[model samples]
Target chain A: MNFKMSVVVRTVADIMIIPIIVFGIYLILHGHLTPGGGFQGGAVIASATALLIVAWGTLKDNKDDFSTMESTGLTMFFLLALLGIIMGFSLFYNSLAGTGGIFGGTVSGINPGYINTGGTVPLMNIVVGLEVVAALSLILYMMAKRSDALEVEE
Target chain B: MLYYILQVLVLIGLVSTAVAVIWFKDLISAAIALGASSLILALQFYLLRAPDVAIAEAAVGAALTTAILIFAIKSTDRTEGYK
Candidate 1:
């Protein structure tokens, strides 16, 4: 089956990809302060993956890499959650808040929002974003590959 | 007034596209219609003050879902039922 689209599509996709990736990253990093978070940002990123597949078909089979990345994200998220419990707080507790950790930096007064004020929330967002991106992209890639192997029914 | 009118128009568009999904004989057309409906729904979500859901819907519902559906259709048949 001819999987590739016209030259117009390929060119547009190539040009549009950078902005989409940047926007997805923006959503992930600003998740603590904005209306979007890990899942949303990851979805946006995965949409880019979908666009690429639609335009040029699956370029490379990265199923194993995606699986490893997904596992790594999930494991890190779990470990980070566990850290809260070890610090004498409940599960998923905000232990790093006001403790002056990397993400626990404090602000003086009613500031808009210090990027560092989210404590473990930002870390959670990061890990969750990683897992979601990997998981969704893998799903798309697998589906595309499976479709390729199928014989079109008459 | 304008807000209410805009909402009404969006809702109308959403409904029409959804109906088009079912009305179309071509599977590809249905998938494209579904994508249009989902995009309109995303706009409705934004109008309802849920930007987060709007973003999610636009990304997943409108883009990814359509692509996946098209992929599925291509593997099977473009027309619904009967060769």
Candidate 2:
């Protein structure tokens, strides 16, 4: 059962997919300094996934992988939040802020944004982005697969 | 002045798209119209200084939701006005 769109759509999708994914990553990484955060960036990446799915119309889905990644992302997120408590701060505290660690620094004034200035915010953004991307992509893949099955049966 | 004009235009587009979504009898057409509405809404969000929301809305509402609805229509009837 071959399921694929015509050549034009597939070509366009192939061309656009990488840029879309890159933009999503940009949103996630700069979330603390920028307008977009984890959820928005993840949605953007998942939209890329949707584009690929729609254009190809079929996929060899590794459902286990997506679910595993989703779980890992959520666990890592909570672990980070819990680590703050272990580090003598409250849960969800900015443990890394002003500590000269990765994603650690304090912005003094209104200026051009630095990527590593948000402490735990960037980390949280990344984890949430990962979870969202994995979950939404999995949903789209499952739905596409199910619809394909229904068509075959009909 | 330009910002206000753009906002007004987007709002008009948004309302018309919303109407089109309800007016279309073909499920796929309606789905596409919904996507258009979502896109316009995203534009409005950006105009309102909320790029985060605009990105989310464009991705989820315009793209993924449209894809999901289209696939759903594939598994069911394409048109909606029939008995």
Candidate 3:
């Protein structure tokens, strides 16, 4: 059965979800310079998933997609760590720092912070963020679906 | 000064909300109280200069936890413990 909230809630969710997702991305991208990082930004995006479930009810499908995304993110994270070791650095090492390449600039003084100055930090942040978002969203979706199924059975 | 006063007030609110969560017989009220407590705790984290913790606490604790609890509550009894 299709279950949805009131028009007002749906409208609010429609308007608010995009901004929430955008803010989460911003947090993930600027994680090295900002206070928030992968876990926090991912939690923010997962909260958006909660909002969507609340407004639109249980999603009919797409559970597999979330699971796949989660797996892919974690795999990429591990691969990056392995790459670090192959490059003669320790596992999870920040090898690209100050190399004058992409994500290699250095912020020497007190400044506003550069977008590409965090080396491997920004990449790890994005990878971990994706994994967290997918995992938490999957949990939320599963819980919602189960609850809905029980409701329909009763 | 004013900052300390605000902090104290927020702490008081946080404690009271925790107590409310324990005291409520209605599970939904307890869940909502828990969400409020989480929100206040996030504010406290911000005041303590931990914006990362504050944001995560707000999003996961206040928002998602409350939503999950509400959904779980819908599938079962609303009263505390056994009827």
Candidate 4:
């Protein structure tokens, strides 16, 4: 089905996108202490990507955009994980920001009390979120686009 | 006592749903049943105090994965079984 939007509707959709992205970030940031974390928050962010693909008509036809973004996200995640490993820590390690304390909070690299204390955890969260968003958006967009094409062909 | 009962009920639900998914005739229905099983498992995860895994399972296993399967079902013939 062709989904056409009025200018006002498009404007509203555009305006709503930012809050969803920000909320995903917030979930990821407070993930360690709360009920949510990297995978969940990443999936939430991916949902926004899917929303954007649906709301923005350009994404429906642009196969290159989705593929490039998916590859870039995957590459960035792997590189970040590698960096964590190379910096004198295990792969996907949480402590790498040195052993300095953040005032009343726990030490930056070692120990562990503050939400932002993890060296690679926050970075990993961001990387995973990016990958998840890109991959999921691409998959959804491809599915929708293919279905539409198949319908037209039939 | 009640908590134990609830846990047992959830476990039974999970196992039954999984078996149904495996033994069901229709692939689409099986996928949906699998998603239901994932939701049940996620609930169990929450009950077991692993909220992170629970949330991930609910979102990916139940929602995103099921959506993908539904799309696949729409794209392919309904009568074909695991080729």
Candidate 5:
């Protein structure tokens, strides 16, 4: 990769990725009431990560690390979802709201319109986000590694 | 309202991109086009008020799927010329 071109493309791509990640975060945080949530925001964030990888190449070469991250993230996500079930709520159910808080909030509590009160939803979001990021990073790393091995062979 | 229009446009875009992916010769370019199609579908999901599904689709469908496809293509023999 030419230094100047790499720098410029990397910088440009990085600049573009930041806002998308921020927007993804916003969606995740405000998911209770809006049209965005953990999965969508997480995916958006993952795309940003993908963009980074495309722009900057693989950040590391330890395939085992990526695999570990993927497994851990997946386990955490499942466990969080399980928490809702163990609490007597349906799987992936949003059951962490009471009945009253901030006016017009999006919380799942007693308050009808609050956005910040979902008990397990936010936690679920975090878990899913982590899983998504880890899964994506691992996949990309593996792909790059495979390509590198092929290049060596050829 | 405007939302419906946006949703329709997104759906159209998604379908068109899917077609483009199918028609494109280069595997990598096709995979990228497929990602774009998935992103458009995600947008449609948002429009349809299912953000969670949308997000999952975008991540798994667009990002993960495309990467896996690219990897698979890279490892396989490149078939000369398109059918």
Candidate 6:
């Protein structure tokens, strides 16, 4: 049925969710020069979603938003990948590197690290992070809803 | 010397947890054991000089999989078979 966790668990979940989300974003944003990437970051964010679902029972159905996000991420990823082709490069090419644009900074030899580098990689990481966050959250939400929906006898 | 010892201990923990996952009769206990196994595996991955795989495994394997299993278990039976 509509099962909500105890107050202690709920409070902890509330407190912990913020850091988890921030770390996930950081993972996605600095994926180029870091150990984490889109998928890992997305999964981390979805874990926060999972924590929410477990702490507080599934109430509002935000499936539509998540669906739109997943679709948008995928479409954007493809568009970004194909943009390199229009720019006279192969699919998934790093055309923006050394261009001094958004994510177009350059890295030479073995420097420390720079955030504004890695061309299309960071862009893909963001899009993939979006898709994964939506996808995994959607999955957790659906399962939580389904579990709630199931008929249980006393 | 210490590094090798730590790696060996982690591997041992990983193997024991894997066995515990199968040995537990209660579904919740089994799920928790599986989570422990995943965590130890993640640690092993970290020790092996692969932090990326370690982070992914720790996040996905230890957390999400255990939550899903518990949720699925709550809907039906909490034990093995019809005992």
Residue A42, model 6: lDDT of 93
Q: B1-83, model 2: which lDDT tens digit per residue?
A: 99899999999999999999988989899999999999999999999998889989988999889988988888778999676
Model 4 DockQ vs. reference: 0.39
Off by over 4 Å in 1: A106-110, A151-154
Cα displacement (angstroms), candidate 3, residue B54, comes to 0.7
The Cα error of candidate 3 at residue A57, in Å, is 1.4
Of the two candidates 3 and 5, the one with more favorable DockQ, higher being better, is: 3
Tens-place lDDT digits, model 1, residues A1-154: 2478999999999999889988999888888777888888999999989888888978597889999999999999999999888998888988888888688887675678778878888889899999999999998887887777876668
DockQ scores for all predicted structures: 0.67, 0.69, 0.72, 0.39, 0.47, 0.71
Candidate 5's residue-wise lDDT over A1-154, tens digit each?
A: 1112378888998799879889888877777666667667767777776677666765556567757766776788788677668889777764555523432224334554455566666666666666666666666666755654665553
Give the higher-TM-score candidate: 2 or 3. Answer: 3
RMSD of 6: 2.4
User: Could you give candidate 2's per-residue lDDT for residues A1-154 as a string of tens digits?
Assistant: 1388899999999999999999999999989888889999999999888888878877676799999999999999999999789999899988888888798877888879988798788999999999999999998888888875764443
Local accuracy of candidate 6 as per-residue lDDT tens digits, A8-123: 99999999999999999999998889899998899999999988988898747899999999999999999999989999989988788889989888889898999989888999
lDDT of 6: 0.90
Sorted on DockQ, best first, the list reads: 3, 6, 2, 1, 5, 4
Ten-residue stretch with the least lDDT total in model 5 chain B: B74-83
| 2 or 6, greater by TM-score | 6
Error of 4 at B70 (Å): 0.9
Query: What is the CA-based DockQ of model 1?
Result: 0.67
Candidate 4 stretches greater than 4 Å from native: A1-23, A48-59, A84-95, A98-113, A148-154, B19-28, B79-83
Candidate 3 lDDT, B1-83, residue by residue in tens = 99999999999999999999999999999999999999999999999889989999998999989988988898777899865
- Which CAPRI tier for candidate 1? medium
| Colliding residue pairs in candidate 6 | none
Each model's C-alpha lDDT?
Answer: 0.89, 0.89, 0.90, 0.71, 0.70, 0.90
- Of 1 and 3, the candidate ranking higher by lDDT: 3
Against the true structure, candidate 3 has what lDDT?
A: 0.90
What range of 10 consecutive residues in model 5 chain A has the weakest lDDT sum? A99-108
